[model samples]
Target: MIDLAHTPVTSVPGVGPKRAEELKKLEIESVADLLGYFPYRYDDFRVVDVAEAVHDTKVTLKGSIYGTPSIRWYGRKKSRLTARIDVNGVYVKVVWFNQAFLKKKMKTGETVVVSGKWDAHRLQLTADRTWFGQESEKHVGRLEPVYSVTSSLSVSWLRKTIYGAFAAFGREIEEVLPQKLRSRYRLLDRARAMYYLHFPKGREEGVQARRRMVYEELFLYELKLLWHRKQEKAADKGMTRRLDHEKLDRFIESLPFPLTGAQRRVVEEIVRDMADESRMNRLLQGDVGSGKTVVAAIALYANWLSGFQGAMMVPTEILAEQHLRSLKELLAPTGMNMILLTGGMKAKEKREALSQIQMGLADVVVGTHALIQEDVIYRSLGLVITDEQHRFGVRQRSKLREKGETPDVLHMTATPIPRTLAITAYGDMDVSVIDEMPAGRQPVETYWVKSDVWSRVVEFIGKVCRTGRQAYVICPLIEESEKSDLQNAQAVFEEIAEELAPIRVGLLHGRMSPAEKDEVMRSYAAKEIQILVSTTVVEVGVNVPNATVMVIYDADRFGLAQLHQLRGRVGRGGGQATCVLVADPRSETGIERMRVMCETTDGFEISQKDLELRGPGEFFGVKQSGLPEFKVADLLEDFKVLELARADAAEILEATDWEEAPEYRPLREYLDRFQKEQAKFD
Candidate 1:
């Protein structure tokens, strides 16, 4: 038995440096990595008669070649090797695309086994894989593991490499779970499970092996989460405040508009959490235009009433300024002074703001990442709120929280994550959702228009502007990238300005300076600009009640949740609003995505559809949604396993601390190793 982790993949026979580099692309660096690289799917080697094979389905057939395989080239780049196999008395055509070398290897009258998709449309079998030899029951009557491959690595190479590593280190596969727990779960021993998972004799064996592996993966993940949760609990004491209901009532009454029921409920949750002995680590999720800012303001006001300082951090300087202004307007009656401390501020201005913040002259502070700089000190920071929470990574949020002694943290995001994913991603924190829209808010009328209908869309925009309302034209790119065919913000701005002559059109994107962006947003809000051409940088914080039209170019490129958020830019003032999506996608999925945009305005519904379409990895990946990557446990397909792992982890933690138990030493060490590896990625 060898140390699998210390043994590199290159040590495997036939895996030179070149092959090792290719394996590295799949994150397989060691013998242990190779063993853990589970197969994505399995293939059945049970041979069936050619006549019994169903069309459009994968099947294996064993027969002898009736004639020599011939290479046919449809074009200079298009070619296929075709052969006819004799099965009993029926003849089935087998085809392999672009592999002309198969013609030389497969001889007439030679026995072969082929597996492929039986294409009924062409009445031919398009071979995905093939083997040449006498059909033996050992290889033809069992299940085979099929691994995901790269262009440089073939399935056969991966299989051979894994087997070679197993031969060398199979005995070193240590068991992390205790024997008693394994018996309770009816799980196979670690070494036997690996063998059965890689090379199983039957479907049941493969299924059981996979189940065992899935449980192990999810159990380890849940256990780590439990550990992290405990660490958060044991952190230094946090702000424990008393609520001033009279002050809250006066603030609520002073507001021009009433808070929605959902908003009120979420605010109550925040207030309750803030008063608890433990710190309030809560995530506030809401759709666009749901008045999340008001709820956040109320929370900050409560902290202020307790004679504690509060901070709100946004992703962009434009957003930070916006929050500063809006909070000033909302909290004017409370007589609390709030100051802005952004990186864009001049030295003199920044010095003054820092002095005020440090001396407790500023009750509330709003800024970008500059608020977390080492030089910035708080007099008595009690509450920390991060707007557009997905845009900030775990490190940034942690840095801000470190400013105070376990400050009550509140994270807010307009990006509507699905309920299940929210639970999984933010499992360590409490969650509150603002599901209801504000009163008198109207649903934006949405439409899907083809690119060819650009003239009509322009005409509509002009009409809306002529009616004294503003419009937004959102392009997917700041500047045209060679890889994408979408319109850029500058190009679209020029085109719209020229087409709609005399109409003041402003441009905004991420590339612009923060001051420049603020200028454009201010102009747009003041109605000095009738139409605004921009990128998704305007997706979060800018608000204008008069903007009633939203035209998104290449809208299909955006997820449904984002498209919904863009639509939310309009219809803010209870007037009729319209959202036009310009796209002409070809795939059924793409077409369905556009259709979903036109069908609903509910952010949660759109997010659910987005999750179903993109899965958890892609959904979280689209934005900087901070979630730990699980190696084998899928939040969707293995959701039940996740639930089981969570429950089991709670029970185990209640019984004993694994680190202190002699029998659980192996599990604790394994968990430590896993946490260290996961931290490298974070």
Candidate 2:
């Protein structure tokens, strides 16, 4: 048996260098890659009797050519080939468009099979695919796989190439799962499953093959995650800290507001993890304004009491500053010395901060990626916290953790993810969610309006402004593009400023410098700018309680999660707030997104809907979130299979001698190969 993973696609009989280049466009560089490239759909070509065919439904028919086929050219490169077929003594008109060569192939008394839509009203059959006598025997009785191909590669050619590859290397394809596991899951053999996946004799067989592939993909991923978790625990010794419950209770009491029940539960979980001897890697997730900051502050304070320095990293400088201010206020009673470090800080300020950090003077340090730079040092770093954890890559988080001596890490995200995604994306870490919001916070009132009602929305914003409350007018684009029809922030700012006189509208976008953005945000927060027209830069960590209304233009252009996040910017104060979504959505998906925004404010529910609509790849971002892309598994549709695979993977890992046992040799070998392949990219 050859090593398929190392063999190039050109090894296949018909695939030359040029053909291999075409395959490379589909990410099929290796024989294994080509085999893993599953078809998006299957075309059922099973023969059906012409008399039994229904109107407008696709059916395959076997018949004899009753007369000579004729071709009529109507225009350049366009022609219609018409013929009559006799099926059981019944004559039916068959039409083929742009297939002039078929006229020469079909003759009187010739047998043929055609798959197409049956038009009962017109008493005709429109053929999409045709097979001459011998070819019909191979295709007319089974489901045909349809591969997604570029224009240079036809579906027929790709299908044939895959079939040839399977015929040549079918036996060489190793079964990664052990025999006992296969029997327990009722899965087909790997080689058989691959063959049936590409060419199934029946629909049931195709479904079974797909199920096997999905389970295998998910099971391998779960195994890798669980194994990493086990390795992390075995490799690193964590700091065990005293809880100091009395000190922590006093610090919590010093806060301006009380913690929600969910926050208290998550706090207890984090404290317990900190008290344990093992390293803590926990994810703290909650909806916007859910007091995650307070909980994080408590954790940092607890770490301070444990007599170690704690560091907090955020995605942006603005968010870093905001956290510094809020945490300072929350933990002021503890007399914990905190320092700020960021890329935008001046040379003198940064030097002083770095010196303080190295001298152990900075008890709680907060900053952006600057904290992870080589120059900064922590004297006794014990706990690491990253806010908006999805925004940073895995390596960045790891770098921050590496700065300490096996420090306990807490990842906090305002974006609430569904349980299925949590299980897959953050499988290596324990998860804690703050599902409750603080008291006195009201649900933002939401409404969907068309472009024709723009006047009314502007008037409503003016009314809100007159009452001394602020509003946000969000656009999808920063500046006008000749190619885009969506509203831009600059243009909308001008229009709204004119429509609502003396409302003090200010424009903020990504194009602005950090200092300029800070100034604009400061104005908005101080009530100097009543309406801030901006792009999606305000989607995260922008808290302005006085902003009572949010009007988003071209809301259809944004995803449900984004829209929910944008709406969260408002309704933070004691006053009732409203969100008006202005969109003239043309597609059903866009319309449905708008409707979902108007229906619910639950971040988790909206995220689930977003996953179903846009899938996991776009939920946050596959690459950014360190999510693995699977060939046959769908995180949304195949969630139950994922759960089963996760459970099985955990069970296998629990065995004391599974790694060295002969029964798990196949699985162990596959994992070794998988890790080596993964290391190449890393």
Candidate 3:
């Protein structure tokens, strides 16, 4: 087998230094990368009789040039070449734009083939590609791969280069999937799949090739994830905690409201994981206002009952303070020592907090990334919980985990991921979802309105505040930008403050300092500010029960998940809350987003819709979410294949000697190379 990874694209025929640079723009530097660069779409150039061809449809015609092609120049570098073709007694007019050079190639009464869209109204065919008599037999009547190309590259050149590479190395292409597995799945071999992927005989062959490639991509990714999980489980010895059922029952009973069934189930799952001999790496996913914080507090209480320190890391200091306050209130009956540690804390305060954490006096510590700092020492840290886990990178989470001796890590996120994303993105960790809302929690009434009804929206906000409740006015931007026409927080704050005089309205944005943002949020939570005009910074953990009205301006500017999160800030209290989406969307996608938000409050459904509309790259932000960018597999469309790959990977790893078995040697080698590539980025 050829070493495709080490083989340069420059080794291919017609690929000089300049051509190699152009190929690099498409991220194809090596022969392997070039082979993986699948076409986005294909153009069918099957020959068709002129009489049988439908007008206004793309068709290829094989015929003899009836006359000499003539060229007419209209402007600089602009010319039109017109010709007549006779296909078995039927004559058709053909035109080529800016191809004056074709005049030399188009000979009178010469056999040629053309592919283009035939216009019935104009009685002409606008030819896109032309080939001579014998060449047409090999080039036409097949699916031609149309690649995404840069300015310096042409589709024909890329196709020819890929063909050349295949001719040289096709027989040497190594298979990564085991023969038994491929037979079971009825998948095409790697070399055949690559050929059919770029140049297929029929649509079914193309589909089969694509399915095989997608499955292989997802299967390898799943293998890597499961392998890492296995390594971690074997490397570390987990702490098996002894649960105090009596104290846990008392704590549950002491809550103001009864636990939801879903909450209870997830808590039980977590407690079971803590008591197990295997270290727990789990994801706790819940929608906004899903009472996840209370569940997390209970988990921390359980850790305390086991006589171990627990650290909760949040994204922002404001969220950290909020968690500290809420955990303190929830754990008040047990007298657990909960302390706050943030980067903004004073020198003396930081020192005291650090000393308490190191001395084991702090039972439940809530803070931002400050908890993972080098100087901060933990005394018997047993559990580590990260809120809004997407905000932190893999290394940051690892740093926090390294703080303790194989601490049980629980990742929490308010962003309810779709099942497809949850399985793939968090494939390394076990996932627990709190899908139920607490009893008596009201759903926020949502409405969509255009900007022409801004007056009515403002009046509604005023009426909501007049009833002794708070409101939130969300804008997409903090300040006016020359590029965007969307409403900004400062302008909206000024407008609302003047519209509703005597009602305190506050402005909060990311541009504000931490202290300033925290002060604004504190005042809003205290009900001193009847209306808070802010950006999506309040989309995560800001909880004000009195804020029953949410008015979002330019709602189309935000994604469906973000809009849902913003609406969740309201409807947390007993009273009926309302969310008004003010938007004048231009595109159908924007309009659909608004419609979806107004239609339902289910974050998972909204997330699935978001995944469908924005795709996984934007939904989970592959760069930050640590999701691998697949070349052929789509997280939404190819979810079934992903499920199969994940299951198959698990079964394969269950075999103790699979790693050493000759049958699995190719997969092992591929995984070894993949890890080395990943290590470079790390």
As for TM-score, the candidate ahead, 1 or 3, is 3
Model 3, global lDDT: 0.90
Clashing pairs in 1: none
Could you tell me how far off, in angstroms, the CA of residue 149 lies in candidate 1 after the best superposition? 6.7
lDDT of 1 by residue, 1-682 (tens): 4768778988878889999889999999998898888787778878888667888899888888987678889888778888999877778899999777777768788888888898766657888778888534457877878999899899988987888877877888988776776888899888878888898888888878878888888887778787777776777456667778888888887898888899889988998888888888999999988889999999999999988999999998878887888899899888999999999899999999999999999999999999999999998999999998878878899999998877899999998888768767888888899999887788898899999989999999998899899999999999878998997998899989999989999999988887898889889988999999999988877779899999999988887777888888898877889999999887777788899988888899999899989888788884555566765567778878778877877677676565587767776777678779878997
When summed lDDT is taken over every stretch of 10 residues in candidate 2, the lowest stretch is 618-627
Q: Higher TM-score: candidate 2 or 3?
A: 3
> For model 3, how big is the CA root-mean-square deviation?
2.9
RMSD of each: 4.5, 3.2, 2.9
Candidate 3: tens digits of C-alpha lDDT, residues 399-445:
99999987899999999999998887788889999999888888899
Question: Local error of candidate 1 at 616, Å?
Answer: 4.2
Cα lDDT for residue 479, candidate 2:
86
Q: What residue runs in model 3 are displaced by over 4 Å at the alpha carbon?
A: 7-31, 49-57, 64-79, 83-91, 100-110, 120-123, 148-158, 245-250, 343-352, 393-395, 481-483, 678-682
TM-score of every model?
A: 0.84, 0.90, 0.91
lDDT of candidate 2 at residue 466, scale 0 to 100: 94
